[model samples]
Target: YFVGIIILPTVREMEGREGESEGGTSTATTIRRLEIEITEKRRVIKREQAQLQLLEQELEKARLQASKEAVIASQCVDEWGKPTQWDDTAHEVLKGVFKKKTFRLHQLEAIRAHLSGEDVFLVMPTGGGKSLCFQLPAVMPGHALTVVISPLLALMQDQVYQLDLVNVLAATLSSADDEYEKRRVFDHLRSMSNKGKQAPSPFLLYLTPEMVVKSKELLAALEAVYKAGNLSCIAIDEAHCVSTWGHEFRPDYRTVGQRVRSLFSSTPVICLTATATFDVIRDVASSMGLGQHRQGGGKKMATFRSAFDRPNLFFDVRYKPQSNKDQLNALLQTVQDCTEKFGSSCSGIIYCLSVKDVEGVAVHLREHDVQAVEYHAKMEVGARKRNFELWMKGHVRVVVATIAFGMGINKEDVRFVIHTTPARSISNYYQEAR
Candidate 1:
């Protein structure tokens, strides 16, 4: 019947061509052609439906594989503290969490070494993303908590604020945080410690060396984390402080390394500093028990060094005037030039050696119609914080402050940094100059 249906059409068409009218076409022949057309259409529809099903299955498989990879990435390390699929995981967090597209020089090396459970000593200049080295590893899922011991409370507060902006879970323990805030942070840690099967919550904790040594609440929280075997790494910011030879030597910093070692012997230590001489480096390494200095010299640490030279920054030095009025004029002239060049969005710092000088300089600048504010250790905490934020947000053109102003400050558009008096030491000069 099928063959006849096909052949009969040709036969009829041939006969019609001999002299049949167009109307002579039969209904049965037309019906047979329509049936064939419907059959072909049905065949195409069936094939398309099968292809769609196959595609859906493949998509589901891909999704499952991605989910599995995410879990593995979160659990970045194996039982022995060896990295598993770290490259993929680190890059994912770098982009997804930190919103950075690429790692700066020596950044990946420092982070990778620390992730593999090796101590790291990194020397990168200010604004070189030094914090990200430890911070990147700290934010990874399934990674243990990272404790950062820093000497400056201002730096700690600034870092915590910035981290919060990016939605990264970070908390700082300092005199700045109120009792309620401190208790909240401590309670969170305690809760994580109490969870038996659940993993300890991952967070970047910033603390001063004194807090590590003196704060019983902080020590208790740390002990809880330590008992859970969830202490990931300890990063010492401004690690040069560990050396007496360094410019900003604090006796409290000396105890931090020893105390951390005694508590969490196996946790990796990352010491980061912007300025460190050979003597300072050796002292820091030895004091931290890193590299060959470790007991039995088990695993040597990796040192990541990037050149401190920032070619984009230009330096100019001029002799100060002996007269106070002349000094103010010179400073004002320099600041005006800088502000004029950068226009309204200009941000700058004028460092003074004392709180009196900071207030005086700020008053002078304001009298001259310069948008300026004063910040120093002696100022009320709220006032200093408010002024700093005003300067950071470009509401103020310049911040006249003491040495307390610039540490860990992330303002990138700052056009000039004018020191009204000489810094106490070369490292202090270098730190504020940035």
Candidate 2:
């Protein structure tokens, strides 16, 4: 009787423990289900946040477009898209597209003459908004196409990129482009020609002087647009390149004027340059065939010239160290000092005479833990482009490059520039420095 009593109690205790484990498993299953639901909710929240950001970006773009249209609607434009009057139309573009509150000296005057279908020769100091004179007209509605003939491919590329940022349609044709890029530009032109004035907006086409003078395919395409009366105006940037007396003369630039005259004689031509002497200006005017001004018969070319005075830039000359080690140390010191004074984002240019010098300086700076890049004609195309972009984006604080590298540099806040060799000419130096 005693043995039966002990065994019966032990069996009851075991049965009680099994009941508790079954209840514990039920609670764990519920907790696991709740965790899964929470994970799914988090995914939904993340996806919705991503969609919200995209919608916000689209809304911002639409807002800017609506504002631009409102400004354009208030201005008066002729059938050909030329401003019927100067002040309101030009000022609207200045504020709407360029985001400037007012016009600089002579900027409005130059635009007025060009938009009024007259030849314009504009000479403004660097950063004087010379480009705005022509660029603003090109963006006007129904303005058709404005052909920009530039001396360097770099300038063409830079301008095209900048115009795109402002929602302006701009394209470039050059040897630097691949076959697909060339075809795309040509196809866009053909499409624009087909639409005529009904085309969505005005287009700016940038080309090197050689492309205008030599490319038969481009010539044929441009001819089609010209015949349709869609070729509005032609702009020659850095026009001094056409003059043999100018500091940087290119023979191909000489033929570009002849091509323009033969094909688009009725189209108004606007030539712009930063620094040109009287002799250079006269040669540019004559060579560019500025109508009666060349033959002393028709309407005189409108001239807008500004003084070359930059009161903000200070110039100092320092003797280079005799030893290479000392030279590099001095350069490193200069860069470090500028960095200390201007902060890490300070951008600078160091001009060297030779490819070897550029490479050496860039490498030395890198070894010293400075973010530096080298650019020269001798570098591979992709490498040159990559290094240039790094400098442009401020990923690299300094660029050691050849003297030719600054022609199309669009950076506005460069803190310092160093020249390892003497400038080729005073005008050349001024152009590069400015």
Candidate 3:
């Protein structure tokens, strides 16, 4: 039997029909929810795309960095494979067997390379053992005669004296030496040459560029020696002077590169300088004809830079008062204080702005019981040398002068360097400080 059900519309059916009549409300709500979900998904995808772009950029940067590192590594490896050696005798000489304290490895290497027939440029600081670079190689086992072109007479004289102290056969070709002494040196060289043997001792001939240019006989003799393979190398000291744009421009240095190139084409050249900026170094190398191919086509020339810092030196700056007398008084007081503290054991130099100022201050110091002397171009060469000698010998504690006083002097124990007037540039200041 089947249960009979009444087919009648109730209250719930009536309510559902009323709701559906309101423009399909359930369908509109469902469509709106779907639109919101799609918008959120699109935002998430856009953020992910941005992150992917950033990752790609980082990857590209890493690749470029790797390529740069590879290039530098390859350059270093090439440098490492270059042929180089140290002269055993020179090493022993520098290793304190000769009573010389401290040895620079780069300086030794530069000398050895030059002796072994390679052009070199030693860019070292002042008092950085530059003399050893050439002096050591001069004594090497060869008929090698080293011709040194010094920028100043005093520097040449100092080198000769130092060599003499070491019992090395050294001579200076300057106008100051008497004719008899000059002839004696020339005859000695000639006798050695006639014997078909190296000179009794290594002969280091020191000459200025101007002297080298003017003396036809000297030039001929040097050229002959160079042709005979007796010339070992030509060292250009104070090589920065070769650059016309440098702070210390020497007109004589301009012709040095051309002369060396013409006369000593096969002989190695060593260019040395205490202070040279990056541009100065490049200009010096170019001026010396060592920009490209060096002697013997060996490894490329290297530059050894020592730090310019001098820990022993104290840096200070004092603003000058409006009154010149006040400034002078203040400077005098400082000099007096330094002298009283350091006594005869210390020496000092005071740099002035002008020649007149130099003279005035030096006179004032002399009058005030400060043993000071003046040095300027206006002074005779003899006077300058005397003043320098007096100061070096500790007879004078203070030297009140222009910038001309410090160049080529190796007074290492100078207690202080004062500039009554500020230096023209940082390079000038650093040179004086060194």
Number of the predicted model whose TM-score against the real structure is largest: 1
Candidate 2 TM-score, C-alpha based: 0.77
Residues 294-337 of candidate 2 have per-residue lDDT tens digits of: 33448666766776789988777876899999998998998888
What is candidate 1's TM-score against the reference? 0.77
lDDT of 3 by residue, 1-434 (tens): 99999997899998888888765987898899999999999999999999999999999987886566445434433443344555457667765324675566466556555666666777667788787878887876663578899876657766776677777778888666668877886775565444366444568899888877777877777776765667777888888878876776778787866688677777777888877656676777677667344444545555555455557667767767788788778888888878787775688889887999998888878888888988786787668768877876778887787766655567766888898877877767776767
Candidate 1 lDDT tens digits, 1-434: 45544435587778777555544566667988999999999999999999999999999987886565444323432222344468789999999988989988767767777777788878778999999999889988777688999877668777887888789888887777778988888887877676467886578889989888888778878888878877888899998888887887788898887788777777889999888765677788778788543456678666766667888888999879999888988999998888778886778989999898888788999999999999888888778778877887779889998877766678778889998888998778889898
Residue 334 error, candidate 2, Å = 1.8
Which ten contiguous residues of candidate 1 have the minimum total lDDT? 72-81
After superposing candidate 2, which stretches have Cα over 4 Å from the reference?
Answer: 1-84, 195-197, 293-297
| Model 2 whole-model lDDT (C-alpha atoms) | 0.80
lDDT score of residue 90 within candidate 2: 76
Q: TM-score for every candidate vs. truth?
A: 0.77, 0.77, 0.72
lDDT of each: 0.81, 0.80, 0.73
